[model samples]
Target: MKKEESFSLEKGEANQELDDDGKPTRTGTWLSASAHIITAVVGSGVLSLTWCLAQLGWVVGTSFLVVFAAISWFTCILLTDCYRSHVTGSRNYNYMQAVKTNLGGRKYKLCGIAQYGTLVGVSIGYTITSSISMAAIKRSNCFYKYGHDKECHTLNTPYMLIFAFIEIIMSQIPDFHKLSFISIIATIMSFAYSSIGIGLSIAKIAGGAYPRTSIGLPTRTDISNMDKMWNIFCAIGDMAFAYSFCAVLIEIQDTLKSSPPENKVMKTATTIGISATTSFYMLCGLLGYAAFGNDAPGNYLTGFGYYDPFWLVDIGNLCIVIHLLGAYQVMVQPFFAFVENWSHRKWPESGIVNKDYTVGCFRINSFRLVWRSTYVILATLVAMIFPFFNEFLALIGSMTFWPLTVYFPIEMYISQVKLRRNSFTWIWLKALSFVCLLVSLLAAVGSIRGLVVSVETFKVFRSMS
Candidate 1:
């Protein structure tokens, strides 16, 4: 086959057929298209989603999830149609690409940069949270086994570093196809973990192992005005971040060869994935709050005693860490590829080094080494400085999640209108589009406020410490 034909075949296999400009043409199957969407949506966020919801009280949190899910579903539909209409024949188009195509190129570049920054921030946040969760499990297990060694009274930095190293190494592998299998495992494990925790929590409540009380719903007076605003903002931020991955559906659609049958399958799969994620978050949040009442720590495991005989939490933590590793890989691969493309002179097109000094031993060119080291050091420092996981999550959601989820879809829809005037028929889509834009904007603003507050709170806590 000719080069174009060869490229086309490989692209088709990956669910992406490139146009002349290297934009993906819609040609892949639905399953292939939705894989990354599933991965992107189901990350460390799910693990903490329950805790975030619990903070707002169960009723509010559950309501937020339903509303956000509905909004996200509608947003995805708008985005899918937008892509089908505007950049239909191009494989080079992504969310940012769509923005650049319709909006100014400079704005698109800025958005792309913001997206990368947010991914890095998110990766660090996930690492830190996973490390803490892992450490909790380790400390609990050690105490269970060694019965609290007085001589080993030092902080377990080694364990954290080891886990971080493992994650860093795992994230460097290039191929996401193989990575998706791991994600499938992680998803299953997450469900298993949350299910067991919920069941155990419920059983304990039933048997009076824990106290349950109605502290009265959160009244305006009960929570201070400022606190209420902060909580509402946090909820909006959570929703934005939770639903942000909706923007990725276009890339996924491109990979599927844009087959009509595949589109339907992708839509169904996307819905199922979102539904499952929402259900998991809601259950974990409700059960978690119900079990511990108001004293419940943000992490679900905190509700249980060390002797709770529930090995699922530990297993779940481990599984989530693994899943996050996979997630980090998916999130960062595009960045890596972009970097490689930009620095082609220093690095060859093929056999790019994937090793990190922090985690693995491998030969690295000076350029690659410097970049990799810089990324690691910077990411580590930020994570350590802002050691609060929820705060980092909020920051990421506000800055990156908003653009990807709400803004990008609106832009894509407008672009589609420009490209295929009167070609498609969606009578309610314009109204739906407006609703997405409004909610997304609200969520983004609320998330930013929450992040600002969290950072300020962190600073205060730091000074006190």
Candidate 2:
């Protein structure tokens, strides 16, 4: 078979795939690409980073944050190279398709399962986060004055319904390229929440507002060494999930104009995006720990002492809700596209395509309306059912880190970037790849253990309630 026939990424004449409302006249600029990455990467993950840092203490957690940032950046380089692997250097619709281009056949199946599962898992996480943020906002008015009022009446389901209502409108716009306008605002939303959290931490420190019960630091003096180590592993899982962006790299790259060395432009965008993420993570994680120590809340907004500047707290948290509303769709779009693609392959005659369709027998395209909404509803329902779901989501997310973030990228680089056999560079890359595989195994096990414990504890709390 010819090299051209062997690869699916080389969609020659069909390169001009239209978004729902518009045709592409030019390639996406690096800034737009950076915005998409920023929107996707810096979601609710930034809020709990203080707790992550506390779990590992400042030195270790900060180190892991930097390390994960570097690792994420490196893997991003590898994925971009894979995006340019074809002779024509065309883009793949997803990482799975890109892998199929190189490895061929059902070799990409695991990628599909793991990739889509991770995305759906992320979507569920956003559902939970948006509800929590809005719920916090709902109860904020009565927070400090707990004794003076009726019990704060807030529920996760209703807030999730509100989010679903908003998403239904956004979901109607089919392609992610169309989300560029929304993503720029979503990127600002990350900055909004992170900046507020940082400002609050500084204010507390300046005012000397440390609580006597608050832990100054998590250390051998504060806890057992076993607990310290366990928490560090948990932090690893947290940062791993936080740094995950490779799952959507290809789809983002596809929107960019197909030109020679466009992947170079992608590298530039990755630098900007990940650097912004690192800055926010460091500021929030370190300052949050400094302000509250081990007593920091899992969600930083609520962790504040509920002081007089409660209005600022509400603004930051509402930003979280707004951010997740956008980020949820960013993650979910890949799952939506994957399912849509699957349906098209299975039913080539189906009218649930990007193209306008005639109402042959049915009044409308039920698959388009029903299937998409069904998944969104399903994700929202999961969020409603499992209130204590972050740990489980982290577990599922960690499942993708090794393969999607590290192993696949390194493997593709070794396969696609030819090097002299037995050369020092070649040996070193292989060794690093092997080490990542080991680390991924350990991280996955730790994440799973955390999930199990969270489930058991949730049940215990449920029984008491």
TM-score of each: 0.76, 0.86
Show where candidate 1 strays beyond 4 Å.
1-35, 82-88, 142-160, 175-178, 209-225, 251-265, 305-307, 345-370, 418-465
Candidate 2 per-residue lDDT, tens place, 1-465, comes to 555542322332245444222344335779889998999899867776877877767667777789889988998987887875566644566789888887665758878887888888888778777777777775776765673255565666778888888887677566677788888899998899899999998998889966322233355466667656655566667778887778998888876654434588789899999999999989988888888777667777766535647688889888888888788778778888788777888888755553454466433345766777887888777766665543644565477688788777777777686667688978887787777666666666766666666666564212110
Q: What lDDT is obtained when candidate 2 is compared to the true structure?
A: 0.73
Give every collision pair in model 2.
Answer: 27-257
Candidate 1 has an lDDT of 0.59
Q: Indicate the residue-level lDDT of 275 in model 2.
A: 95
Stretch of 10 with least lDDT, candidate 1: 150-159
Total backbone clashes of candidate 1, pairs 3 or more residues apart or in separate chains: 16
Best by TM-score: 2
TM-score of 1: 0.76
